[model samples]
Target chain A: MQLAHHSRAGGSVLVWTMLVMVILSLLAVEVLRAVSGRFQVGVQAATWQEALLGAESGVDLAVVELRKSLYPAPNGAWQDWTTVPGNGVLSHGLTTVPNAGLAGSPMNIEVNVDAPAQLKDPATGWQYYRIRTLGSLPLSGPPRVSYNKEDNRLRKLTLLNQRFIDGLFTSETNDAHAARRIEAIIRPLGSFDQAIMSVGVLDLNNQNIVIDSYDSRDPLKSTNALYPYNDRNADGTLKRQENGNIATNGSILDAGGAHVYGDVSTNSGTATGVANVTGEQRTDFYQDPIPIGAPTWTSINPAPSTVTNNTTLTASATKGAASSRYVLRAIDLSGPQTLTLAGNANGSQTYIEIYVTGDISLTGNAQLTVAPGVSATIYFKGDVDIAGNGLVNTNNQPGDLLFYGIQPDTGQNPYVKLGGNGAITAAVYAPGHDVTVNGGGSDGHVFGSAVGKTVTMTGVTNLHYDEALSSGGLINNYKIVSWFEDTR
Target chain B: MKLQLKKSGGFALSEVMVSTAVFSAVSMGLLMGFTSLERNFTATADFATNHADEMRISDYLALDLRRALSVQAAQNDTTILIPAYYDNAGNPQTPALDGRGGVVYGAIGSSVRVRYYLSGSTIYRQQDSAAPITVAMNVKDFVFNVTDLGKVVTTRITFNPTFMAGGASAAATAATAFYNTTLLRNSRTDIASSVY
Candidate 1:
């Protein structure tokens, strides 16, 4: 019984030892499994992070390519990437070799450009454009991985167009109030001659007024009336009737409520009005005003009451209407006809009309003066070229001079030149071509109402205003006019 | 024969008593050693896991705090976007601003905003955006400080793990656990201070 008991007890002890060992082994296996599982999780997390970084790299590459294509080169021409020669690769060192999985997978990038079509020359087909690029990065990664994306960008550019209008208008004053109140209306007919279509009004003040009859109030209308206030039309004739009205489809009145049968202008302070009309008005008024039955003065052969050359013209002019209205006409001189006046004469407030059947030229220091309450009208069939220190003065408070031209009835190619330190306190009006005030020193002022189809300042010209002035077209002082072109 | 049998019986009884006493003593010693070892092992494992988790969360939060860009305040100025950091893809997250004001190193909290502050050795993280996660309790010392033009954000957290042995209370465990202070530093000095 003792031996049997000993054996049984030993066997039970052995079984208990075996059970402890098995339990220990199982626990070790479980611990090993847990550790391995955790390590595997760490590896998986790292791999995903790497994949995300790779995707980010692709985005960076696309941005670089976009910036490169948009920037201009040193040359005038812009870079073109549309017709990429081989494999559509832009030769700026941006390239990628195909990997094993994504090898030979052609990645095509397309750039959509939107810009002004007018910039492209119809003949050369060269144009400026703003480009938006979309690059596709095709990949052969695992099915679980996604690798496609899109981005957008914007750029601005300029191009050349054949139908661009190059013209400028400069204000002679710094007053914001004056600039806001003064309006220039320019109407051009036929070909647009920059030289003949500009009007310069120098004495701009707080109350200065410039009425532009040619400028169209509507911008969308492509007819002559389009862009009334903003652009110059091709006709070259800007008309403002007596009351300050522009004749378009009908009579377009000025802001001052004036009626103008033809183009009308006044000094800065003049309260002028215009008459309204509708539809295109008759262009007949602009025709040559020379009547066929008018008597022609062959010559001042007897030399009308001539005096010493030094005597100023104002001292000798007769006060009567017959003497004051004497015509010193010339038959033939040069292409520029000259009439030399030498006398000491004065006249009552009368009208002095100088009619030139052809181009008129005035030389030497000729002084012509009209007495108080007097008005003079100089008519020339051709251009008027005045040189030397010539003085043409109207002594009356509201004295005026109207220069009418014949031939070229279309209001083109007419020219007026004023040179030297000449002083003229008179209202001068012209309809066609241009008026140039040149050679006057900085101190002198030309006080007048100058209405020209286009007025340009050739040299240093000072315009002094005792009253008001207006113009029908553009006023350009050549040196500073180029900056206003819209390059976009 | 009877006398011999009686003497053997006494010897047998004495042997039984002696064996029982020895067995009892040995079993008690072995049991005590096993219990002690088990407690130590469990304490080590729990301390390791807790420390690791704390370090991981600290690192994650430190990264977010370092990359903070701007702090924006709500209408009341009581709540603000603190440590507002943008992700790699430029997606903005809250906590736009960070820094210390007086003894508190945090910004204002809104309904969906949070502020981090330190009091003594305990670090409290409060969020109005969501229910606050205690994050770490029984901390011996916790500090979030800035330096280097507000670019460097350094955090130090100290805790005790030995107190956790034998199912101890958090306070007790924290007091007795292995005391370790971890310093987590991140570079995001451009982050503006919280103005909220």
Candidate 2:
């Protein structure tokens, strides 16, 4: 019985051993299978990751393309998908899949791209665009990643005119015509006391202007007929007007006043002054201060026995035709005249007074030449024309010759020309006109005062002591002979 | 006594026969189980390894393709070339196989060339004077598709492996080879718009 029990136990032990071996083997195989499955999973995940990266790469490419198009070809449109050369294929041994699961799969892929939408309309404002990309991997083919993108761009816009009255009015309706018709009157009571009287009428296109002198000499004349008289005392105590002759009692008889009617033109001299109807007191009318011995009579045939202080000269006359040539010499005038200095001869030592008169034309090769070291004054009542190569040399001494004129109050800045190779050294006073020096050969030094106008020197080599006291003018293209002051 | 001895001996023989038959059946059953387990383990290992390799390959492909600037193809359309910039090196040689059985990769001019037969088993990548690097071995097939936009480029690559390790052969069979599709956008637009 013991022997039999031992054999059975041994047999049982052997069977147990065999069963354990089989279990161990099965466990090993299962572990190996699990490992293999994990490997396959890993490979799949890798492939998906690669595809994703590829998709990102595609998006980057699109960005680059968009940038290129927007900058290089601003006017060109952006569309379509493009392949980068050598990008489709992989490097040797870099991505080798031995015994891969899929067979005959297409590794190379074509990308279809949608049109890029505008992000912002420049005319409207901000805009945006949607970009979509698809990376298609065929069944049993190489994997591919599809890419999509959306972007935005900002747009900007650019005013053209900014001036007042650029095209408002024509040249004829400008301010030049309005100034000539208006005149202001001033009355003097004493040395400092002054008042405004009645205004006067003047031609808008008048070439000449004149200021009349007041007379105070005679007595026993009624002062009421003087029109706008300044009676400061108003106590019936009459005083003689400034720049006038009066008697000892200071009672006015002939209250001397001047009148300017229409536009005065003349060929000879005439006396024009205001007188009282009774003629008890005689007075002389004067605008400027008369010298103590002015109008000195030199060539008198028969000297008058007693010179009357009340007698005065203020009228003007014209000499010679516009076409005639005349040589002017030194002469004295007790009154005004319009002397035309024409001809091929030179004018020397000539003195003339022009109150209110017509135009003075200097035709031909006339030279209104004032000799040096001599004094001369030409007071023009009208426009002075120095045409046809005519020359006016005002340089007589350091400060000898003077050209004085009352410029019409027109707003137009009329020009005065020294046209030849002549030099002028004078204090020219034109209260309302601009002085222009034109001509290449002309040179002069002008020391003068011009109110309310510009002194332009064009094509001139030299000018001296020139002053302008207003605006709306320019001084250009000329050489200044000496220092000048401009008060504006 | 003699009768008892003869009977016992005969019974012993029968017992031995029965035990042998039983042992043989048990052994066969254990052997079959172990064999099945071994096969499963092997399949798992293969799958894990192949998956890792696939991941590595896919990553490499994506990175290289990302650097692609342009693409060129041979006249026959079987060979493709890719020009790419790598790091600060500016230009680097990178050739890939098309999975065909032909000579499909080399460096030509300034581009990397890739060539393979449509029925090739391995994808070969070659550069000038450089030994070819096999990108995908035991590959069943490979294909490439390239798309063109006027200013942009897209390249797609697909490949299949030959060996399938696990019962996941069905999944493997349906599985597509790793592929990278890249779009190369034009870089001139930004520069063109800059006035300076």
Candidate 3:
């Protein structure tokens, strides 16, 4: 009986020991697996971040291709980009990073650009585009370690059963790839890129000349989007904003004490009195060529209207209506001849293109008034002399009144002269003419932009450039207005 | 009956010695296994802690560099200076014009300056006149390469080991440096202007 009991006890001890050993071994395996899993999670987080950066690179590539279209090209080629048949979008096929020849890029990026959408100012034909991009990095490939000494990249962490390269970490067994999708909107930047652009010498030759800017689209900058600005400070005081810029291709000289509330730049030309410029004063600047050409008139129905002294000449056109044209003869106003330009009587936004064949010589207090709701562009072929009360813009919208000097095929010298006390709210575009802005004490406000071959300003002419015009001109450059990621 | 009892006592003595030896061997094996597991767990925890610290610093610096208006050399103990262009909730401080056409741009670019500095192994961040607070610890070296003209800022950090017993960690580093480059946003072109 004693022998039997001893053998039974011994057998029980052996069985219990085996069971405990098995349980302990399982726990060890589970702990190691948990540790490996934690390491893998860290790798995934880093790889996803890298994928996002690649997606942004795709967007930048799309912007470069779109900008190329701005220049004259064959069929507006976007560098071999194909069109999406359904949406007409230009798609850049999936391409590996680092271009070709460069090694160690394990990512791919693709770009797409949609067709242009016309802007509000249909006359300019300005447009914006939508761009989409896709960036992805596959982790299913064999894991790689070791830094590329040739590329001078930092050495990756020697992870256990993992891979890390170029700031991206991944597991050797990871089969799924991460992707990032981004969409951005590219739009034409503001029109009047600057307050003034001169092809020749721009002389601010007077001390009392003031250069400032104000935005008419903002109610705080202008009263009801007009003049008599709304006090943006809520302090019941009108202040000039420091964005009234000026630039010239030739020398900018003799700016004697003229407080330019904006920037001044020139291409290999000196700018005098830079101390007076509140904004940046720079040289060696570059600008696009300003070409002021007359538009080809359609000569459609509703014959061109003629303006007479003491009469209201009406210029009318509705949305989607055929553009209208007007004829104004070059005549010297001998007395107090007042010509009123009125919009459509039906309360429609009307725009007209006027053709002036002769010189406009205003003497004494002879004034040409621009009524409300009228947008006019006077294409003059001769010299303009506004010596009287100047162009009286009752609407006070600078963009509403534009003077386009047409390059005459063969004619007399081209010049535009403004010498009156009345505040002129108009943009003058004559790249080949000598623009002279004289007279006007503190009450003389020239609220517009000027692009002349040579602009000479004197007296106390307060050139209050309309900041809103910056949004008007043709698309000078491209800008990303809005960008976001598509999480889906 | 006397002979059988004597034989039983002698056999019990031998069995006790053998059983004690076996129990001791098993206990020692188990103890060794547990000690090794504890060491590995500690080594992994140290490595993870170090990696997390490095990631945190890289992410935080990238964010700060992207939003900074300017990156100047630490003057009088200040390492970096960022403007208050964003509020506490990460929303832009928009400057609005009043109904009277006047704009008070205090909200757009405020006078509040977010500053950073390093003291020994700790990095402290202070906003304007506020007291400095510790942002990071155990830093061996921190360097900033600022290209003002390019509007780019590159930051590199060197960290000390959390546990020196891991035989050179796979993730954390003491000799190798981790760096990040960030392009700035909302830069004031007038202050430090660059031409393309």
Lowest summed lDDT window (length 10), candidate 1 chain B: B96-105
Q: Between prediction 2 and prediction 3, which has the larger TM-score?
A: 3
Model 3 quality (TM-score): 0.56
- Candidate 1 per-residue C-alpha lDDT over A1-488 given as tens digits, one digit per residue, 9 for 90 to 100: 89997999999999999999997998688666544543432332233223222322333333333334322233222244333222222222122323311334433233323333332324222222222222222323221211100000000100112111221112111211000000001111111111112232322221123322221222232234221233333565333212222221112212133112223232222222333322222322221111112224453323343222332222224322344434434322222223332233343444454555555555664444444444555556567766655545434231244444433455357677766674545433454535665536544444444445445444433333222122111111101000000111
Interface RMSD of 2: 37.3
Arrange candidates by TM-score, descending.
3, 1, 2
Mark the 10 consecutive residues where model 2 chain A has the least summed lDDT.
A149-158
Write down the TM-score for model 2: 0.26
Candidate 2: TM-score of chain A is 0.23
Q: Provide chain B's TM-score, model 1.
A: 0.50
Residue-level lDDT of model 3, residues A388-477, one tens digit each, is 575888667888888877765555568999877857788887776888886576677788888777888867567888877766644445
DockQ in order: 0.01, 0.02, 0.05
Cα lDDT of model 2 by residue, B1-196, tens digit: 9998788667577888999999999999988977776666565544444444443334334333332323343211233333322213432222222121001113322334444222365544454345655554544434444443323334344443334442234455446444445333212121211100
RMSD to true structure for each model, in Å: 28.3, 40.9, 14.0
lDDT measured at residue B21 in model 2 versus the true structure, 0 to 100: 92
Candidate 3 fraction of reference contacts recovered: 0.00
Candidate that scores best on lDDT: 3
DockQ for candidate 1:
0.01
Candidate 2, residues A408-458, lDDT tens digits: the string is: 434543434444444443344333334443333433222222211223333
What is the lDDT of every predicted structure here? 0.34, 0.30, 0.61
lDDT of 2 at A46: 37
